[model samples]
Target: MHEMSIAEGILDVALDTLRQHDASVIHSVQLDLGLMSGVEPDSLLFCWEAVTKGTAAEGSRIEINTIPIEGKCLDCDKTFPVENYKFICPYCDSHFVQTIGGRELQVTSMDID
Candidate 1:
């Protein structure tokens, strides 16, 4: 799965940051993963465990903050959560809607020791 590669990327960043701060161990990694990002949390966690073996990040916690899909209607100028992947505007039933958020996939913070 692609999560393996993703996990490797995360480890790379964590190690780079550890070197920058001169830390000996990493306690945790926080990520902002959105609902529409299409990345499975469980799979990512499993891959993380595999990729971190014998590394400084081994046994570290991974905190995933789920972000909801949000959209804005151009017709009514109203913003609301996009339920069930529906792009229709709730206020005006308009098809002209712009997605405002929920595609995030990034590491926000790390706890190092």
Candidate 2:
């Protein structure tokens, strides 16, 4: 599905990096995946393996760091995890909670030979 496209994009970035650094192969690709990024890790991994066939990143590893949803309470001035998709602040039961983290989908780094 969309994971295939995402995987392809990742490969493109890795290849571009490889060429820029004049590296022979990509050893690994690191990614920051947040809880609300809506990207499936399993599907992404499967697509990654399929798309990397015969390429410079053929056997490269995909390292995903999962980030949890965090929110900061404007009323209580406290930060906590947003559970069960509830935006309410746990400290003050306030609805004015702002999301501080999560919802991330970015390539952080790559390891090359």
Candidate 3:
């Protein structure tokens, strides 16, 4: 699954950073996850435990900071939540909407030992 790959990548980066500093453990990881990123929190949580089973990140807390789905309406000049992934602007009934946020997946920080 893609979540596995994502978890692996996160672990890889954490491991690399720890190795550089000769650190032996990772206490926590902070992640910024967006609603539009199409990631299931439960799935990611499950993968985190499995991926970190034997690594320095084992037992590390995965903190997910969720980002809201925001969009800018082209016709109404208003910004609102993108419900159901629809691009239509509710106020103006226009289909032209620019996504303003909520499509991000990134590692915000890590607590290393």
Models, CA RMSD each? 1.2, 1.5, 1.9
Global lDDT of model 2: 0.92
TM-score to native of every candidate shown: 0.93, 0.89, 0.85
- What are the per-residue Cα lDDT tens digits for candidate 1 across 7-45? 999999999999999998988999999898888999999
Model 2 bad stretches (over 4 Å): 74-77
Worst 10 residues of 3 by lDDT: 81-90
For all candidates, the clash counts are 0, 0, 0
lDDT: which is higher, 1 or 2?
1
Q: What global local distance difference test value does model 3 have?
A: 0.91
Q: Which 10 consecutive positions of candidate 2 have the poorest summed lDDT?
A: 83-92
Task: Please give, for residues 7-108, the per-residue lDDT of candidate 3 as tens digits.
Answer: 898899889989998999999989999998888889998999999998889999889999988999988899988888898888898998999999889899
Off by over 4 Å in 3: 83-86
Give the Å shift of residue 11 in candidate 3: 0.8
lDDT of candidates 1 onward, in order:
0.94, 0.92, 0.91
lDDT of 2 by residue, 30-87 (tens): 9999998889999999999999999999988899999999999999999999988899
